[model samples]
Target: MGKLIISVNTKEMILKSYEMGADEVVISLNQCSFNGLKKISLEELDSNIPVSIFFNCCIFPEQIDEYHSLFEKIQSLKIQSIYFQDPIIILWAREFNCLEKCIYRPETLVTNQMDANWWYSRGLKSVSISPLITLEETLHMIRNVPNSECVIHGHLMMSYSKRYLVSAFTNHNDLPSLRNNYDLTIQEEKRDGHMPIYEDENGTLIYTDFVLESFNELPILMKKGISRVFVNGEFLKDEELLDALSIYKQIMEEKDVQNQIVSFFEKYKETSYSKGYYEEKTIQ
Candidate 1:
Protein backbone atom coordinates (compact mmCIF):
# COMPACT_ATOMS: atom_id res chain seq x y z
CA MET A 1 0.00 0.00 0.00
CA GLY A 2 1.05 3.60 -0.60
CA LYS A 3 1.99 5.91 2.23
CA LEU A 4 -0.65 8.24 3.69
CA ILE A 5 0.30 11.89 3.27
CA ILE A 6 -1.64 14.60 5.10
CA SER A 7 -1.42 18.37 4.75
CA VAL A 8 -0.74 20.19 8.01
CA ASN A 9 -0.41 23.77 9.20
CA THR A 10 1.26 23.69 12.61
CA LYS A 11 4.02 21.78 14.36
CA GLU A 12 1.45 20.53 16.84
CA MET A 13 -0.62 19.13 13.97
CA ILE A 14 2.57 17.62 12.59
CA LEU A 15 3.30 15.78 15.82
CA LYS A 16 -0.31 14.73 16.15
CA SER A 17 -0.31 13.33 12.63
CA TYR A 18 2.84 11.38 13.42
CA GLU A 19 1.24 9.89 16.50
CA MET A 20 -1.82 9.06 14.41
CA GLY A 21 0.36 7.02 12.02
CA ALA A 22 0.56 9.36 9.03
CA ASP A 23 3.48 8.25 6.85
CA GLU A 24 4.37 11.81 5.88
CA VAL A 25 3.07 15.33 6.38
CA VAL A 26 3.10 18.24 3.93
CA ILE A 27 3.39 21.90 4.94
CA SER A 28 2.91 24.94 2.75
CA LEU A 29 5.45 27.72 3.08
CA ASN A 30 3.76 30.95 4.09
CA GLN A 31 3.28 33.05 0.94
CA CYS A 32 4.23 30.23 -1.40
CA SER A 33 1.00 28.31 -1.94
CA PHE A 34 -2.18 29.28 -3.82
CA ASN A 35 -4.44 27.00 -1.83
CA GLY A 36 -5.86 28.41 1.43
CA LEU A 37 -4.10 26.04 3.84
CA LYS A 38 -2.60 27.64 6.90
CA LYS A 39 1.01 28.37 6.00
CA ILE A 40 4.06 28.19 8.27
CA SER A 41 7.54 29.61 8.42
CA LEU A 42 10.67 27.58 7.69
CA GLU A 43 11.97 27.90 11.28
CA GLU A 44 8.96 25.93 12.55
CA LEU A 45 9.44 22.84 10.37
CA ASP A 46 11.38 20.67 12.78
CA SER A 47 9.60 17.33 13.06
CA ASN A 48 10.35 13.60 13.48
CA ILE A 49 7.97 12.51 10.73
CA PRO A 50 9.00 12.89 7.09
CA VAL A 51 8.07 16.35 5.74
CA SER A 52 7.27 17.38 2.20
CA ILE A 53 7.19 21.10 1.47
CA PHE A 54 4.39 22.32 -0.79
CA PHE A 55 5.30 25.32 -2.99
CA ASN A 56 2.55 24.95 -5.53
CA CYS A 57 1.87 28.56 -6.41
CA CYS A 58 2.43 30.44 -9.62
CA ILE A 59 5.43 32.75 -9.57
CA PHE A 60 5.88 36.25 -10.84
CA PRO A 61 9.20 37.35 -12.30
CA GLU A 62 9.81 39.95 -9.59
CA GLN A 63 9.20 37.33 -6.87
CA ILE A 64 11.70 34.93 -8.38
CA ASP A 65 14.68 36.26 -6.42
CA GLU A 66 12.82 36.09 -3.12
CA TYR A 67 11.62 32.57 -3.83
CA HIS A 68 15.09 31.54 -4.97
CA SER A 69 16.57 32.68 -1.67
CA LEU A 70 13.82 30.87 0.24
CA PHE A 71 14.44 27.74 -1.76
CA GLU A 72 18.12 27.88 -0.90
CA LYS A 73 17.33 28.18 2.80
CA ILE A 74 14.96 25.20 2.66
CA GLN A 75 17.72 23.05 1.11
CA SER A 76 19.34 22.78 4.55
CA LEU A 77 16.26 21.11 6.03
CA LYS A 78 15.58 17.37 5.92
CA ILE A 79 12.81 17.62 3.37
CA GLN A 80 11.60 14.34 1.82
CA SER A 81 10.13 16.01 -1.27
CA ILE A 82 9.16 19.37 -2.70
CA TYR A 83 5.81 19.48 -4.48
CA PHE A 84 5.97 22.29 -7.00
CA GLN A 85 3.79 24.02 -9.62
CA ASP A 86 6.19 26.31 -11.44
CA PRO A 87 8.79 24.68 -13.69
CA ILE A 88 11.27 27.37 -12.62
CA ILE A 89 11.53 25.52 -9.34
CA ILE A 90 12.82 22.55 -11.30
CA LEU A 91 15.63 24.72 -12.60
CA TRP A 92 16.41 25.85 -9.08
CA ALA A 93 16.37 22.25 -7.89
CA ARG A 94 18.81 21.29 -10.62
CA GLU A 95 21.04 24.27 -9.82
CA PHE A 96 21.02 23.11 -6.19
CA ASN A 97 21.72 19.54 -7.35
CA CYS A 98 18.56 18.15 -5.71
CA LEU A 99 16.31 17.55 -8.66
CA GLU A 100 15.42 14.12 -7.32
CA LYS A 101 13.67 15.73 -4.37
CA CYS A 102 11.11 17.47 -6.61
CA ILE A 103 7.56 16.34 -7.39
CA TYR A 104 5.68 18.12 -10.17
CA ARG A 105 2.14 18.96 -8.98
CA PRO A 106 0.47 21.29 -11.49
CA GLU A 107 -3.17 20.80 -10.39
CA THR A 108 -4.89 19.78 -13.64
CA LEU A 109 -2.05 19.61 -16.15
CA VAL A 110 -0.56 16.15 -15.71
CA THR A 111 -3.62 14.28 -16.93
CA ASN A 112 -2.05 12.01 -19.51
CA GLN A 113 0.54 9.23 -19.32
CA MET A 114 2.87 10.89 -21.84
CA ASP A 115 3.07 14.15 -19.92
CA ALA A 116 3.49 12.31 -16.61
CA ASN A 117 6.16 9.99 -18.02
CA TRP A 118 7.99 12.93 -19.55
CA TRP A 119 8.37 14.58 -16.17
CA TYR A 120 9.37 11.31 -14.46
CA SER A 121 12.00 10.78 -17.14
CA ARG A 122 13.32 14.26 -16.44
CA GLY A 123 14.34 12.89 -12.98
CA LEU A 124 11.54 14.01 -10.72
CA LYS A 125 10.83 11.48 -7.95
CA SER A 126 7.15 11.69 -8.85
CA VAL A 127 4.39 13.70 -10.47
CA SER A 128 0.96 14.14 -8.94
CA ILE A 129 -1.67 12.84 -11.34
CA SER A 130 -4.39 15.41 -11.96
CA PRO A 131 -7.36 14.80 -9.67
CA LEU A 132 -9.74 15.89 -12.46
CA ILE A 133 -8.95 12.91 -14.65
CA THR A 134 -11.07 9.76 -14.88
CA LEU A 135 -10.09 6.70 -12.85
CA GLU A 136 -8.95 4.86 -15.95
CA GLU A 137 -6.70 7.78 -16.93
CA THR A 138 -5.24 7.83 -13.43
CA LEU A 139 -4.60 4.08 -13.51
CA HIS A 140 -2.84 4.43 -16.85
CA MET A 141 -0.46 7.07 -15.49
CA ILE A 142 0.31 4.97 -12.41
CA ARG A 143 1.14 1.99 -14.58
CA ASN A 144 3.49 4.07 -16.75
CA VAL A 145 5.09 6.53 -14.39
CA PRO A 146 7.82 5.38 -12.03
CA ASN A 147 6.11 7.08 -9.10
CA SER A 148 2.66 8.64 -8.84
CA GLU A 149 0.56 10.56 -6.33
CA CYS A 150 -3.18 11.02 -6.04
CA VAL A 151 -5.38 13.24 -3.91
CA ILE A 152 -7.68 10.71 -2.28
CA HIS A 153 -9.66 13.16 -0.20
CA GLY A 154 -10.12 16.87 -0.09
CA HIS A 155 -11.77 19.87 -1.76
CA LEU A 156 -10.49 19.59 -5.31
CA MET A 157 -9.45 22.93 -6.76
CA MET A 158 -11.45 23.23 -9.96
CA SER A 159 -10.00 26.51 -11.22
CA TYR A 160 -7.33 29.09 -10.48
CA SER A 161 -7.04 32.54 -12.03
CA LYS A 162 -4.52 35.31 -11.74
CA ARG A 163 -7.32 37.86 -11.79
CA TYR A 164 -9.01 38.81 -8.52
CA LEU A 165 -12.44 37.67 -9.62
CA VAL A 166 -14.18 37.83 -6.26
CA SER A 167 -12.70 41.20 -5.53
CA ALA A 168 -13.65 42.44 -8.96
CA PHE A 169 -17.22 41.23 -8.63
CA THR A 170 -17.70 42.58 -5.12
CA ASN A 171 -16.11 45.94 -5.94
CA HIS A 172 -18.19 46.20 -9.09
CA ASN A 173 -21.37 45.76 -7.07
CA ASP A 174 -20.30 48.42 -4.50
CA LEU A 175 -20.01 45.73 -1.80
CA PRO A 176 -17.29 45.24 0.76
CA SER A 177 -14.20 43.45 -0.47
CA LEU A 178 -14.33 39.72 0.25
CA ARG A 179 -10.71 38.98 -0.53
CA ASN A 180 -9.10 36.39 1.74
CA ASN A 181 -12.43 35.52 3.24
CA TYR A 182 -12.47 31.74 3.57
CA ASP A 183 -16.19 31.54 4.23
CA LEU A 184 -17.14 33.03 0.85
CA THR A 185 -18.58 30.93 -1.94
CA ILE A 186 -20.02 31.46 -5.41
CA GLN A 187 -22.56 29.58 -7.48
CA GLU A 188 -23.33 29.40 -11.19
CA GLU A 189 -26.64 30.78 -12.33
CA LYS A 190 -27.90 27.28 -13.13
CA ARG A 191 -25.93 25.41 -10.49
CA ASP A 192 -27.63 24.33 -7.26
CA GLY A 193 -24.70 24.13 -4.84
CA HIS A 194 -22.37 26.94 -3.83
CA MET A 195 -18.69 26.34 -4.64
CA PRO A 196 -16.03 27.62 -2.29
CA ILE A 197 -14.09 30.57 -3.68
CA TYR A 198 -11.22 32.54 -2.17
CA GLU A 199 -8.73 35.13 -3.30
CA ASP A 200 -5.23 35.48 -1.91
CA GLU A 201 -2.21 37.49 -2.91
CA ASN A 202 -1.47 35.06 -5.67
CA GLY A 203 -4.93 35.02 -7.30
CA THR A 204 -8.42 33.58 -7.07
CA LEU A 205 -9.28 29.91 -6.61
CA ILE A 206 -12.53 28.02 -7.07
CA TYR A 207 -12.93 24.57 -5.58
CA THR A 208 -15.34 21.75 -6.30
CA ASP A 209 -18.78 22.14 -4.75
CA PHE A 210 -18.35 18.85 -2.86
CA VAL A 211 -15.44 17.36 -0.99
CA LEU A 212 -14.02 14.42 -2.97
CA GLU A 213 -13.93 11.16 -1.00
CA SER A 214 -12.35 7.94 -2.28
CA PHE A 215 -13.14 5.24 0.28
CA ASN A 216 -14.71 3.07 -2.40
CA GLU A 217 -11.66 3.44 -4.65
CA LEU A 218 -8.89 3.23 -2.06
CA PRO A 219 -8.57 -0.50 -2.53
CA ILE A 220 -8.11 -0.08 -6.25
CA LEU A 221 -5.56 2.73 -5.77
CA MET A 222 -3.54 0.60 -3.37
CA LYS A 223 -3.59 -2.37 -5.70
CA LYS A 224 -2.43 -0.18 -8.58
CA GLY A 225 0.77 0.71 -6.66
CA ILE A 226 0.25 4.45 -6.21
CA SER A 227 3.30 6.00 -4.55
CA ARG A 228 1.34 8.26 -2.25
CA VAL A 229 -2.25 9.08 -1.32
CA PHE A 230 -2.79 12.68 -0.20
CA VAL A 231 -5.40 13.92 2.28
CA ASN A 232 -5.84 17.66 2.15
CA GLY A 233 -6.64 19.47 5.38
CA GLU A 234 -7.59 22.84 3.97
CA PHE A 235 -11.01 24.13 5.18
CA LEU A 236 -11.37 21.23 7.62
CA LYS A 237 -11.48 21.58 11.38
CA ASP A 238 -8.83 19.71 13.36
CA GLU A 239 -11.38 17.37 14.91
CA GLU A 240 -12.87 16.54 11.51
CA LEU A 241 -9.44 15.98 10.00
CA LEU A 242 -8.42 13.80 12.90
CA ASP A 243 -11.57 11.75 12.58
CA ALA A 244 -10.91 11.32 8.85
CA LEU A 245 -7.29 10.39 9.47
CA SER A 246 -8.34 7.77 11.99
CA ILE A 247 -10.86 6.26 9.64
CA TYR A 248 -8.44 6.16 6.70
CA LYS A 249 -5.78 4.64 8.93
CA GLN A 250 -8.18 1.92 9.93
CA ILE A 251 -9.15 1.21 6.35
CA MET A 252 -5.51 1.13 5.17
CA GLU A 253 -4.67 -1.28 7.97
CA GLU A 254 -7.34 -3.63 6.59
CA LYS A 255 -9.24 -3.91 9.86
CA ASP A 256 -12.69 -4.51 8.36
CA VAL A 257 -12.59 -1.93 5.57
CA GLN A 258 -16.22 -2.31 4.64
CA ASN A 259 -17.25 -1.39 8.17
CA GLN A 260 -14.69 1.38 8.39
CA ILE A 261 -15.81 2.92 5.09
CA VAL A 262 -19.42 2.72 6.18
CA SER A 263 -18.51 4.38 9.44
CA PHE A 264 -16.53 7.00 7.57
CA PHE A 265 -19.52 7.93 5.39
CA GLU A 266 -21.85 7.99 8.40
CA LYS A 267 -19.52 10.26 10.31
CA TYR A 268 -19.48 12.86 7.55
CA LYS A 269 -23.07 12.41 6.41
CA GLU A 270 -23.81 16.09 6.87
CA THR A 271 -20.96 17.17 4.57
CA SER A 272 -21.28 16.79 0.81
CA TYR A 273 -18.95 14.11 -0.57
CA SER A 274 -18.54 12.79 -4.06
CA LYS A 275 -16.26 10.55 -6.10
CA GLY A 276 -15.21 13.64 -8.14
CA TYR A 277 -14.24 12.86 -11.72
CA TYR A 278 -13.05 9.38 -10.89
CA GLU A 279 -16.00 7.65 -12.58
CA GLU A 280 -16.85 10.40 -15.05
CA LYS A 281 -15.59 10.25 -18.62
CA THR A 282 -15.01 13.21 -20.89
CA ILE A 283 -16.11 13.52 -24.49
CA GLN A 284 -13.33 12.90 -26.95
Candidate 2:
Protein backbone atom coordinates (compact mmCIF):
# COMPACT_ATOMS: atom_id res chain seq x y z
CA MET A 1 0.00 0.00 0.00
CA GLY A 2 0.97 3.61 -0.42
CA LYS A 3 1.73 5.93 2.48
CA LEU A 4 0.11 8.89 4.25
CA ILE A 5 0.84 12.47 3.20
CA ILE A 6 -0.34 15.46 5.26
CA SER A 7 -0.21 19.26 4.85
CA VAL A 8 1.38 20.99 7.81
CA ASN A 9 2.12 24.68 7.42
CA THR A 10 3.80 25.39 10.75
CA LYS A 11 6.92 24.05 12.42
CA GLU A 12 4.83 22.73 15.28
CA MET A 13 2.42 21.00 12.94
CA ILE A 14 5.27 19.34 11.09
CA LEU A 15 6.81 18.03 14.31
CA LYS A 16 3.43 16.88 15.58
CA SER A 17 2.63 15.10 12.32
CA TYR A 18 5.91 13.23 12.40
CA GLU A 19 5.24 12.24 16.00
CA MET A 20 1.83 10.98 14.94
CA GLY A 21 3.24 8.72 12.21
CA ALA A 22 2.76 10.65 8.95
CA ASP A 23 4.81 9.09 6.18
CA GLU A 24 5.42 12.38 4.46
CA VAL A 25 5.03 16.05 5.39
CA VAL A 26 3.74 18.72 2.98
CA ILE A 27 4.90 22.23 3.93
CA SER A 28 2.51 24.70 2.37
CA LEU A 29 4.09 28.10 1.77
CA ASN A 30 0.73 29.42 0.71
CA GLN A 31 -0.76 29.18 4.20
CA CYS A 32 2.18 29.80 6.52
CA SER A 33 4.60 32.71 6.87
CA PHE A 34 7.54 32.26 4.55
CA ASN A 35 9.97 33.79 7.03
CA GLY A 36 9.46 30.81 9.31
CA LEU A 37 10.04 28.34 6.48
CA LYS A 38 13.06 30.24 5.20
CA LYS A 39 14.74 29.64 8.55
CA ILE A 40 14.47 25.89 7.91
CA SER A 41 17.62 25.14 5.90
CA LEU A 42 18.18 22.22 3.56
CA GLU A 43 20.33 20.49 6.15
CA GLU A 44 17.37 20.44 8.53
CA LEU A 45 15.16 19.06 5.78
CA ASP A 46 17.81 16.59 4.69
CA SER A 47 17.78 15.02 8.15
CA ASN A 48 14.06 14.40 7.94
CA ILE A 49 12.07 11.80 6.06
CA PRO A 50 10.39 12.56 2.72
CA VAL A 51 9.02 16.10 2.65
CA SER A 52 7.26 18.04 -0.11
CA ILE A 53 6.77 21.78 -0.51
CA PHE A 54 3.51 23.26 -1.72
CA PHE A 55 3.08 26.55 -3.59
CA ASN A 56 -0.60 26.52 -4.42
CA CYS A 57 -0.70 29.58 -6.67
CA CYS A 58 -0.66 29.64 -10.45
CA ILE A 59 1.44 31.42 -13.07
CA PHE A 60 0.12 33.19 -16.15
CA PRO A 61 1.81 33.66 -19.54
CA GLU A 62 2.33 37.35 -18.76
CA GLN A 63 4.20 36.50 -15.56
CA ILE A 64 6.97 34.57 -17.26
CA ASP A 65 9.59 36.46 -15.27
CA GLU A 66 7.77 35.68 -12.03
CA TYR A 67 7.63 32.04 -13.04
CA HIS A 68 11.37 31.94 -13.70
CA SER A 69 12.11 33.62 -10.39
CA LEU A 70 9.86 31.19 -8.50
CA PHE A 71 11.54 28.14 -10.00
CA GLU A 72 14.99 29.61 -9.38
CA LYS A 73 14.08 30.26 -5.76
CA ILE A 74 12.85 26.71 -5.26
CA GLN A 75 15.82 25.20 -7.10
CA SER A 76 18.32 27.29 -5.19
CA LEU A 77 16.96 25.86 -1.98
CA LYS A 78 17.76 22.37 -3.34
CA ILE A 79 14.31 21.05 -2.41
CA GLN A 80 13.41 17.96 -4.38
CA SER A 81 9.62 17.49 -4.31
CA ILE A 82 6.87 20.06 -4.90
CA TYR A 83 3.20 20.37 -5.78
CA PHE A 84 1.72 23.15 -7.91
CA GLN A 85 -1.84 23.55 -9.15
CA ASP A 86 -1.26 25.91 -12.05
CA PRO A 87 -0.92 24.64 -15.60
CA ILE A 88 1.61 27.29 -16.57
CA ILE A 89 3.80 26.58 -13.57
CA ILE A 90 3.57 22.86 -14.28
CA LEU A 91 4.86 23.46 -17.80
CA TRP A 92 7.61 25.72 -16.48
CA ALA A 93 8.64 23.03 -14.02
CA ARG A 94 8.75 20.50 -16.83
CA GLU A 95 11.00 22.73 -18.94
CA PHE A 96 13.20 23.68 -15.97
CA ASN A 97 14.20 19.99 -15.57
CA CYS A 98 12.63 19.28 -12.14
CA LEU A 99 9.55 17.61 -13.62
CA GLU A 100 10.38 14.29 -11.99
CA LYS A 101 10.12 15.85 -8.53
CA CYS A 102 7.04 17.88 -9.44
CA ILE A 103 3.62 16.39 -8.77
CA TYR A 104 0.44 17.76 -10.32
CA ARG A 105 -2.30 18.84 -7.93
CA PRO A 106 -5.43 19.09 -10.08
CA GLU A 107 -8.87 20.39 -9.30
CA THR A 108 -11.42 17.99 -7.75
CA LEU A 109 -12.89 16.91 -11.08
CA VAL A 110 -10.19 14.68 -12.60
CA THR A 111 -11.59 11.14 -12.21
CA ASN A 112 -11.01 9.48 -15.57
CA GLN A 113 -8.16 7.00 -16.04
CA MET A 114 -7.26 8.59 -19.37
CA ASP A 115 -6.78 11.94 -17.66
CA ALA A 116 -4.53 10.31 -15.06
CA ASN A 117 -2.58 8.56 -17.85
CA TRP A 118 -2.19 11.85 -19.71
CA TRP A 119 -0.58 13.53 -16.70
CA TYR A 120 1.64 10.53 -16.02
CA SER A 121 2.72 10.51 -19.67
CA ARG A 122 3.68 14.16 -19.31
CA GLY A 123 6.16 12.95 -16.63
CA LEU A 124 4.28 13.86 -13.50
CA LYS A 125 5.40 11.36 -10.85
CA SER A 126 2.06 11.58 -9.07
CA VAL A 127 -1.45 13.07 -9.38
CA SER A 128 -4.10 13.78 -6.75
CA ILE A 129 -7.49 12.18 -7.50
CA SER A 130 -10.57 14.33 -7.02
CA PRO A 131 -12.61 13.59 -3.87
CA LEU A 132 -15.88 14.05 -5.76
CA ILE A 133 -15.61 10.65 -7.43
CA THR A 134 -16.96 7.45 -5.83
CA LEU A 135 -14.63 5.04 -4.06
CA GLU A 136 -15.02 2.55 -6.92
CA GLU A 137 -14.07 5.21 -9.46
CA THR A 138 -11.07 6.22 -7.38
CA LEU A 139 -10.03 2.55 -7.12
CA HIS A 140 -10.29 2.17 -10.89
CA MET A 141 -7.91 5.06 -11.44
CA ILE A 142 -5.54 3.71 -8.80
CA ARG A 143 -5.40 0.37 -10.59
CA ASN A 144 -4.98 1.83 -14.08
CA VAL A 145 -2.74 4.76 -13.22
CA PRO A 146 0.59 4.67 -11.46
CA ASN A 147 1.38 6.83 -8.43
CA SER A 148 -2.21 8.05 -8.00
CA GLU A 149 -3.24 9.71 -4.68
CA CYS A 150 -6.48 10.90 -3.11
CA VAL A 151 -7.76 12.70 -0.04
CA ILE A 152 -9.09 10.43 2.73
CA HIS A 153 -10.39 12.92 5.29
CA GLY A 154 -11.02 16.55 6.24
CA HIS A 155 -12.68 19.31 4.13
CA LEU A 156 -13.17 18.86 0.39
CA MET A 157 -12.45 21.40 -2.35
CA MET A 158 -15.71 21.95 -4.22
CA SER A 159 -14.85 24.71 -6.69
CA TYR A 160 -12.12 27.19 -7.57
CA SER A 161 -12.07 30.46 -9.51
CA LYS A 162 -9.10 32.41 -10.81
CA ARG A 163 -10.74 35.71 -9.91
CA TYR A 164 -11.02 37.30 -6.47
CA LEU A 165 -14.78 37.33 -6.75
CA VAL A 166 -15.57 38.52 -3.22
CA SER A 167 -12.89 41.19 -2.84
CA ALA A 168 -13.79 42.67 -6.24
CA PHE A 169 -17.07 44.12 -4.91
CA THR A 170 -15.74 45.24 -1.52
CA ASN A 171 -13.52 48.23 -0.70
CA HIS A 172 -12.96 46.80 2.77
CA ASN A 173 -9.40 45.56 3.27
CA ASP A 174 -10.45 42.74 5.57
CA LEU A 175 -12.62 40.46 3.50
CA PRO A 176 -13.25 36.75 4.13
CA SER A 177 -12.96 37.91 7.72
CA LEU A 178 -16.34 37.18 9.20
CA ARG A 179 -17.39 37.85 12.78
CA ASN A 180 -15.91 34.48 13.68
CA ASN A 181 -12.49 35.51 12.31
CA TYR A 182 -12.48 32.41 10.10
CA ASP A 183 -13.56 31.44 6.61
CA LEU A 184 -17.27 31.83 5.87
CA THR A 185 -19.49 28.93 4.97
CA ILE A 186 -22.81 29.80 3.37
CA GLN A 187 -25.69 27.86 1.95
CA GLU A 188 -27.48 29.04 -1.17
CA GLU A 189 -31.21 29.57 -1.09
CA LYS A 190 -31.97 25.90 -1.72
CA ARG A 191 -28.64 24.25 -1.19
CA ASP A 192 -28.43 21.34 1.21
CA GLY A 193 -25.75 22.61 3.59
CA HIS A 194 -23.09 25.22 4.29
CA MET A 195 -20.00 25.50 2.09
CA PRO A 196 -16.75 27.23 3.06
CA ILE A 197 -15.41 30.05 0.88
CA TYR A 198 -12.09 31.82 1.26
CA GLU A 199 -9.77 33.95 -0.85
CA ASP A 200 -6.00 33.58 -0.83
CA GLU A 201 -3.13 34.44 -3.16
CA ASN A 202 -4.44 31.79 -5.57
CA GLY A 203 -7.97 33.23 -5.59
CA THR A 204 -11.22 31.93 -4.14
CA LEU A 205 -11.59 28.30 -3.04
CA ILE A 206 -14.98 26.81 -2.23
CA TYR A 207 -15.36 23.63 -0.21
CA THR A 208 -17.98 20.94 -0.55
CA ASP A 209 -21.49 21.15 1.00
CA PHE A 210 -19.89 19.49 4.01
CA VAL A 211 -16.48 18.34 5.22
CA LEU A 212 -15.64 14.92 3.71
CA GLU A 213 -14.74 12.22 6.26
CA SER A 214 -13.92 8.71 5.07
CA PHE A 215 -12.23 7.26 8.15
CA ASN A 216 -14.18 4.01 7.99
CA GLU A 217 -13.64 3.57 4.29
CA LEU A 218 -9.91 4.21 4.40
CA PRO A 219 -8.92 0.60 5.05
CA ILE A 220 -11.04 -0.66 2.17
CA LEU A 221 -9.44 1.95 -0.09
CA MET A 222 -5.99 0.78 0.91
CA LYS A 223 -6.93 -2.82 0.33
CA LYS A 224 -8.41 -2.00 -3.09
CA GLY A 225 -5.06 -0.56 -4.28
CA ILE A 226 -4.98 3.04 -3.12
CA SER A 227 -1.32 3.28 -2.26
CA ARG A 228 -1.44 6.85 -1.01
CA VAL A 229 -3.87 8.91 1.08
CA PHE A 230 -3.58 12.66 1.69
CA VAL A 231 -4.73 14.23 4.98
CA ASN A 232 -5.71 17.72 3.85
CA GLY A 233 -6.38 20.01 6.80
CA GLU A 234 -5.26 23.26 5.26
CA PHE A 235 -8.30 24.98 6.74
CA LEU A 236 -7.71 23.69 10.26
CA LYS A 237 -5.69 25.07 13.16
CA ASP A 238 -2.60 23.59 14.79
CA GLU A 239 -4.39 21.89 17.66
CA GLU A 240 -7.15 20.69 15.38
CA LEU A 241 -4.54 19.43 12.94
CA LEU A 242 -2.71 17.52 15.65
CA ASP A 243 -5.92 15.90 16.74
CA ALA A 244 -6.83 15.09 13.18
CA LEU A 245 -3.45 13.55 12.50
CA SER A 246 -3.56 11.41 15.63
CA ILE A 247 -7.05 10.20 14.78
CA TYR A 248 -6.07 9.14 11.26
CA LYS A 249 -2.95 7.39 12.46
CA GLN A 250 -4.85 5.61 15.15
CA ILE A 251 -7.45 4.42 12.68
CA MET A 252 -4.81 3.14 10.32
CA GLU A 253 -2.79 1.28 12.93
CA GLU A 254 -5.20 0.25 15.67
CA LYS A 255 -7.34 -2.87 15.55
CA ASP A 256 -10.41 -1.46 17.33
CA VAL A 257 -11.16 1.59 15.26
CA GLN A 258 -14.88 1.30 14.58
CA ASN A 259 -15.80 2.53 18.02
CA GLN A 260 -13.16 5.21 17.76
CA ILE A 261 -14.63 6.47 14.51
CA VAL A 262 -18.14 6.41 15.93
CA SER A 263 -16.98 8.36 18.96
CA PHE A 264 -15.24 10.88 16.76
CA PHE A 265 -18.40 11.49 14.77
CA GLU A 266 -20.34 11.86 17.99
CA LYS A 267 -17.94 14.49 19.29
CA TYR A 268 -18.15 16.47 16.06
CA LYS A 269 -21.70 15.64 15.12
CA GLU A 270 -22.66 19.30 15.33
CA THR A 271 -20.06 19.90 12.66
CA SER A 272 -21.23 18.44 9.38
CA TYR A 273 -19.02 15.78 7.74
CA SER A 274 -19.67 12.70 5.65
CA LYS A 275 -18.54 9.84 3.43
CA GLY A 276 -21.63 10.18 1.27
CA TYR A 277 -19.83 10.74 -2.00
CA TYR A 278 -17.68 7.68 -1.45
CA GLU A 279 -20.70 5.44 -1.94
CA GLU A 280 -22.73 7.56 -4.37
CA LYS A 281 -22.07 8.82 -7.90
CA THR A 282 -20.33 12.13 -8.52
CA ILE A 283 -22.24 15.23 -7.57
CA GLN A 284 -23.68 17.22 -10.47
The lDDT of each candidate is 0.83, 0.67
- Regions of candidate 2 where Cα sits further than 4 Å from its true position: 30-50, 76-80, 172-181
How far out, in Å, is residue 5 in model 1? 0.9
* Candidate 2 residue lDDT tens string, 1-284: 46787876555666678888787787755331111121233334543355677755555557668656756656755454677666665667767788877777765547798987888778876888877788888888888888888888767777777666556645376544332123566689977787777665456667766667777787777776776788776556566556666777776674667776677667666667778578889445
Q: For model 1, how does the per-residue alpha-carbon lDDT over 1-284 read when each residue is reduced to its tens digit?
A: 67888887676798798788788788878777778677788877774446888888788989999999988988888888899989998899999998998999998899998888898888898889999889888888788887789898888888889999988998999999887788877789998777888898888888888888887787788778888888988777676777777777776776667776677678778778888899898677
Q: Pick the candidate with the highest lDDT.
A: 1
TM-score of each: 0.93, 0.81
Residue ranges of candidate 1 with Cα displaced over 4 Å: 47-49
TM-score of 1: 0.93
